[model samples]
Target: MQKILLFTLILFGIDSIFAVTHFLQYVYSGSSGIPNLPEFMTVGLVDGEPFTYYDSNIRREVPRQEWVTKAVDDDYWDRNTQVSMDTEPVFKNNREIAKQCFNQTGGIHTVQWMYGCEWEDETGATGALHQFGYDGSDFIALDFKTMTYVAPVMQAFPTKQKWDSDRARMDYLKSYFTQECIEWLKKYVSYGKSTLERTVHPEVSLLQKDPSSPVTCHATGFFPKGIVVTWQKDGVDIHSDVWVGETLPNGDGTFQIASKLTVKPQDWKTNSYSCVVQHKSLQDDIAVLLEEKNIKRTNQGGVSWGIIVGFVAAALALVAVVTGVVLWRRSRTGYGKAGTSDTDSENSSQQQPKA
Candidate 1:
């Protein structure tokens, strides 16, 4: 009876140990598929084995449910989906993306597409469309039907990374439109050939004098083709003579136009002058401040005279010292000879007296 009891106890201990080890391994391996696992897999397996084992069978039976539950609970999946949707239109060459983004965000006001001839010719399609809006903003091609937005990866205008604000970006766009785009448009687009023009404006600089002298000012800007240049004084047109400088072509196929206007000294301060440029796409003026060109004199007043006098005085003092030394030596010689003669005469007289 003792042997049988002891043997039964040993078997029970062995079975418990094996069961604990298996439970721990299962819990540690996350075979339960629960969102949160227990701290001690052995304890959880001992208590949760039936539940976890049953869940695994259920998951295998209803795979679709498992997928749906995972999708609903996973934050990472949602974020990735949003990003994928946002970038889909750009990569798919769909223009409707812009419209969707605009409508959804209520941020973009307008969209325009300016067509380029080169692109059209190469692709056998219409050129790219340049879009603009009332808010001083613009977008390119957007396909409303397909919900797609497509923009050139690289554009002539400064990109968002290069500018601090939308206003700065717009300003750069306007400048580029006047300087580079218009010329390119004219070359490629049939309609632009007749509408584009280039112009030049001149200014004046002042030279410093009793009051000051006036200098000529010149500036040049590229436009389409037939732009005009004018001078204005205090907002009034200056009727002064204007010289038109030669227009050179910018290597980029744009015109380099120049103008010169002669301004007088009296007109420098009394009137505010500006060089006005007028073009099909741009109407602006550059104000030139008449700056005084004063000559800088390194040697002013009698500052050098003091330096010359000091040098001459030092040389004269040196010569006087040498002359005094020579005179002293001659006097010493004369005194010595006289003293010797007197001594000899005294000795002779004394000897004669003694005789």
Candidate 2:
């Protein structure tokens, strides 16, 4: 049997994306009296992983690199110089501005300067945002979305016309804010995308829905996102009762989704209910058929004991035919037929679909 590649349609409502998550965060943490402060930035996850890039106003604030570079070669020196030396003071000024913003906000907070693009199937599909945030508080540093500052700054507020003019200047400056964030963002996404893995196609199971059992099809652990999971009853397509969910990340970077249909109890009894999945990676759609013979308990909603018994009787007859044919062949040639050679074998073949 072909393997199942996807899942059911009960409306899981997972957010879908045309692109994966891409993010850059520049953060600053400081005490009441400190001339030099720590520096950090990350991609994808916040500070969940190691710092993708770093810089500090004072050289002493830089983290020791011996442990990190021991495994790396001499070529790593170039990157070290770029992040810690050439670009160090840029974030230093940003750090001071961020620290000022944090103190103004009246809390012990780290400033999160984020710049990135993202896409989701729900709400909206594609978007990008650049903003400043306080770690534990709810205030913005530089509100890039509106091109304004969310909290009061050292500089006084401007007139309407002056605000627009300053905003235009701010826009020009942000084009260069990456310093190292954008490059790091690219490296982060590249590494994430490279670690791809394929999952076993979704499993489809049934629950009798009073007069019918809603068949749920789950297609999980696939990558590059385009997989179609649909329901078919008695070899015919179903629509009115079918639903398909959005593709969601599996954290491992692979994706999963579900599709479902409510099938009638009568149809469930005598017909083939197959959840067919199609993906470009696969040569053909994998079909998982809910068969009557496999259903137990004649009266247990989905059970079809009559058909199960019929299959048993047919199976026994076919076995007898094959045994007799093997015996006759052995008697004549002194060797049994190694495979099916009886007339009943012809009846067991199924009609293949035309291309």
Candidate 3:
């Protein structure tokens, strides 16, 4: 079974050259024997930004984005809430069925259903996916070509057979992916245009904890996630001795990354060194020289910049780490990438859509 690549849907900034691709996705998860978490949870995302959420504990479908709340009325929420309420039992039943199929008495287990659609405005191209997972692995998925369900594991074959035989369910899924899902995606995009379509360039900072430690080029507050941070030596890209961190989400829906270069103090002094940032938001790459004066010093006098920044950076890093761990754990138990389906069109069965 192919693992869902969580970062496959790449949302572009405003200055992008390529045409934008939008995504609408809903993930439903049900878990057993997990503590301090809702038994069933649902998340709806548009262009990778969560717009709505529902959990057993809340028992209500709530809008996560301000625009979502503004765009839809109380009736909309009420209707979706009912839908989610109905879905909760189905997810619970799925979990129980999955446990039995696996022959597990169960310590902790999860069942997940992820379904969504993607549309490319420029090309009139569309794609869709619907998949079910059992214990972090692919259980069954919809096959567009066969117009039937596929089982990845023997334990899931029964489900595939049953679902394939259910003509009503199959037709509903087909319509949901290609039609209903795309309509909803377009509506959400229209509602969140300003927030989703705009771009914010990164704030570049050269940070160094100490002279002996590697110098880090930090770029924060960029929108749309796609970015490149690299080290340059004497006007040339330097690949070795450089560690580029993963792009991480900021609290305000932007992104940040850090690229560290290991070099001797003498080496950088003798040869010109710089950190370069490339993004759709910028017309040209922004380069910050690796110079002592430009460095954001962490060695200030008594009770200074070092203490404050060190504390804040540490806190932010801790939060990112914890959040990543939680998401990773959830993905391991379910909540992974959408399963790839067989289809005629190249864009018809993507695992996840870029928005």
The numbered model that scores best in lDDT is: 3
lDDT of 3 by residue, 1-355 (tens): 2212222433222213244777777776667787776777777777656677778888987777899877776698778888778767666666666566567786877766667777777776677767766565666677665678766566656556666677876676677777878887888889999887888898888888788889988888787667778899999999999997656555456767778899999999999999999887899999999999888765653223343344334422222121122233333323223331111111122223212
Q: How much lDDT does candidate 2 score?
A: 0.37
lDDT of 3: 0.65
Candidate 3: where are CA atoms >4 Å away? Answer: 1-17, 32-35, 99-108, 134-136, 145-154, 205-217, 231-246, 258-274, 289-355
Candidates' TM-scores? 0.23, 0.37, 0.69
Ranking by TM-score: 3, 2, 1
lDDT of 2 by residue, 96-197 (tens): 554553345333333333333332213322233333333323222334345554333223132122434565456553554323344444444444432321
What are the RMSDs of all candidates, in order? Answer: 48.9, 25.4, 7.4
Please list all clashing residue pairs in model 3, or write none if there are none: 4-337
Candidate with more favorable, higher TM-score: 2 or 3: 3
lDDT by residue (tens digit), candidate 1, 1-355: 3322322222222212122111110111111122332111110111111111111112211111122233223463344334333322222222233334334333322111111111122322211112211112222222222222322222312222222233443454444433443343333233222222122332222122234322333222343323345667777767566665433223222333444456665775577766565544444444444434322111343123243234333321121111121122122211101000001111111111000
- Give the RMSD in angstroms, all C-alphas superposed, for model 1: 48.9
Sorted on lDDT, best first, the list reads 3, 2, 1
